[model samples]
Target: MLGSVTTVEGIHYKTKEPVTIHIEHGRIKDIQPIAPDKNNDSLPWIAPGLVDLQINGYYGSDFNTIPIAKGSVENTTRGLWKEGVTSYYPTVITNGDEEIEQALQSIAAACDGDPVSQAGVKGIHLEGPFISPEDGPRGAHDKSYAKAPSWPLFQKWQEAARGRIKIITLSPEWPGTIDFVERCVDQGVTVSIGHTSASAEQIDEAVKAGARMSTHLGNGAHLMLPRHPNYIWEQLSQDGLSACIIADGFHLPESVLKVILRTKGEKTLLVSDAVYLSGMAPGTYDNHIGGRVVLTPEGRLHLAENPGLLAGSAQLLPWGISHLVKNGLAALEEAWDMASVRPSAFMNLPSQNGLTIGAPADLVLFELIEQRMTIVQTYKQGNRVFDLTTSTKE
Candidate 1:
């Protein structure tokens, strides 16, 4: 039982004020304002532990590469908890049907009898197999394995996922994709547009068909494009689309990042898009997508062939928040929302109980040391899942 839990509640979604959050048995019991205590050493700026809707892999473990073993999923969940992510969707990229099926099965089995596994692994994000086949737009995906959206094929994958597939990202302009988007929407699955070369009209149609998000908005496309007309601009201008951006500083330039933050504001969700190389020692490694990637000196993962092209990201949610705050792209509260509440809302989860009564006891404790957000602890369902000080000692 927490004696007196406190959080700094955001006022008007941009400013924070001290508020107490009481928890009992993994759920929020009460929330109330508290006077500042001079004797208390704990900082009051607590927030909900982040929820990542798109995570590929971390700590040298790729869900796509990891064999479907009993402990692999559990180990991955533990790794994610250390990064302050209390919940996330394990993203699976374009791959063979058999491989994808096996991954889903493993994830489902891992969720059994494990709270972190069950809570951390909300669902699966299928990122491809139905996407643009063009070179630049396809990014690191294998061209041979890419295919147009086929309901029959999707049905097979969905069955293998055992109804745990929550989101599917595909190109809206692909043949039969509009129908596919409709079908997914009808089944309560989110359809995101990505790896595309779609026209404005096609994008609009996809939105009408319930396509709601753009995956890694600016990372998968060609570097140069015709002025005043581009798919990036089209997607940016669409009011119905929420964009996920990799804020690892390499996927997009500072200018473009500022433009996106200013334009999208609360509509933008921060995604790591991290690969297996994340949290690993710096060196060259072969991405499963058959390209050579180098973990850079500055700690970013970049495509070895084209320095401009990003292989993936190494940043986590807390790091992204700190970067955004340091760069003046957004206020600390807004950045926190992007990492925590916005993504949850986008995934259709409740944004309430963020230090409020009757909410889940999913919380993060951090301090701003010289304006840097440093995570000190992470709590899931009222259990202390991660503590940086404790982990460091071990």
Candidate 2:
């Protein structure tokens, strides 16, 4: 019955009111403000589930690798639930043409085989094969596969992915970048500038050609640059482009994070950009991107061979949010918005604000205890996908 409901009482994120959210048939039916129920004091704050735009992999599963192990994607989806993420994009980076096609097909197959995986996966983020091939700007992506942007190549990828590729990051300095960006825009795909040494004019032209965002704005670049006229400053000053930051505290310093947050304000998005070792224990491990990466106890992942450069992030989105709050880079609410609201809104997704009637009941219940944010429960479309209390009992 429409009237039959499961009432979820908590402090609402937007109104900051104590309300009982009624759920029926995987949607929020109603939200009625209620007096504080002292008997249910253990309830946590309710907010929109987190959305990550770029997650390469987690727990030893790299999305760019073809022939993924059995249940790898499903396991990764469940791992994300532990941190209150309801929706995310599996990022596919630079690889051989055959490997890239196989990876996309594997992701599509996982979505087809599992309802939960399909629900959590928003789409795919293609992060490479069209970026700068220079050593520093190329970062960890294989140089062999890096090349100029091509429309036909993207069309083939789209066909293999079953049209699930929603975002692509590329360098605007390439020869055919403008035409490719325009075509992607026409097809309702998001274009982000990254891993490039594009001049200010190139950046402006890319924006004019329909680039809407900067992928992990402060990363995938040379270690040093001129104080002015650099790609970073150009993207920051561009009013037409939004920026995504990796707030994991390793990719960017706190001072840089604060500056970007201030400059971009509402346009800033927080992404995990996590790799295969994200959820693994701290240790040295061999990886496909780099020869060897060491996960330090301080939660930093560095190339064991070089030791000067980072491999990728070892933390998820929640840790980034918590790090921002703890380091005073941003307030709790502001950081949460970057992870949950801003990314979805930038992607033109529905229900950017949480707990509205008739919207899917995708919600997260969390609390800040002793300055550490903890996930109490996570729900997707009104189904209890994760519960810390229940999991411990089992």
Candidate 3:
């Protein structure tokens, strides 16, 4: 029940038809549509594995914490497969120069040492020493370490990461941001705007300089803004930029998510932006970054002092996908794509082909019962990784 197989049978995620997907040599070899049997209604839905662009860490592993533990990256990678995530970027946030370098080196070393990490960690997301230092925009990042983007400094981190840093999130508020964005894009790193108070004109300039994404577009900004000239408006207007959002229900309201989805269309992507507390039990937990945080039974992670404030995203892609479907912001197929296929396409990964022959055979089997998505199994590179039928893990 938990071993690798040549083929997987499930209901097609898109067409809702019974299908037999054949896998070989870690790639999809064939996809056969089959006539529905009486038991077809009980089959799980088959979909492409999720690709998360900005996950910080999982369970007890933290990328932001200085001196990442020896096997943390490997542990995080294996933990994610259970959540149906086959590819992901491990996000390292603002910190002291040496701390960031050390963090990168540890992750790079883990990837080099562990086959699972090497395969699952698509890249590292360097989320800042280059973001806005303003109170509201800075979020939980250390303001003392915030500074202008520097290509040479990034190169040092990239070297430490073994050139695994693929996405860099920075604010375009600094004077030379356009040049920095250009440089990052030149090195094949995705330049994303985030944690900013930049003007619309500045955002336009960054986009022109090849900034192609917005990290959690509507968050990490001043709570109040000018009606039409704000950074959010500017990002939404830039057709060249794909917007990643945190759809944990608490991070954004339905109206805003709906608007962004309609505006960006296929450009809309979902990111958990999850913290180490994710996948933990429902209880109050001490967080070094935010003092005290609470993870609710319903999966909402918020500040313990004030329930109104969000601590961080404590859920995975399935929660976000289910939230979208439940809220009527999108149907199940489109919502699933936002968390899986869409991110892969944005990053130009092979999984973008999604349930088609010739793509990487990273796949998931799940069932949606009244908007709760239960991952039944997950396969990475055509090999079964997680099977709920035999797992006793949380």
On TM-score, the leading prediction is 3
lDDT (10s digit) by residue, model 1, range 1-394: 1233333232222335556666776788776655666533455467887988788888777778746545766777888777778888888888888887888777777786676688778789999978888888888887887888988878888887788889998988777888999999998899988988788788889999999999999978875777867889998998888999888777787788898888887899988877767778888988766578888778787778987656778778877888888888888888888888888878877543365577777888777776566667778777777877888898
User: Pairing residues by index, what is the TM-score of model 3?
Assistant: 0.98
Would you list the C-alpha lDDT of every candidate in the order shown?
0.79, 0.87, 0.91
Candidate maximizing lDDT? 3
Tens digit per residue, CA lDDT, model 2, 1-394: 0123377777776666778889999889898888666755666888888999999998888796667677778888988888889999999999988888888888988998999899889899999989999988898888999999888888999999999999999999899789899999999999999999998999999999999999998899998999898999999999899999998888999899989989998999999999989878999998877788899998899999887789888888889989998998888778888998788888877648566898778888888876688888888888878888887897
The better-scoring model by TM-score among 1 and 3 is: 3
Residue 56, model 1, lDDT: 81
RMSD of each: 2.9, 2.4, 1.3
Each candidate structure's TM-score, on Cα atoms with residue i matched to residue i, is 0.92, 0.95, 0.98
Rank order (by lDDT, best first): 3, 2, 1
Stretches of model 2 off by over 4 angstroms after superposition: 1-5, 37-41
Candidate 1 vs candidate 2: the TM-score winner is 2
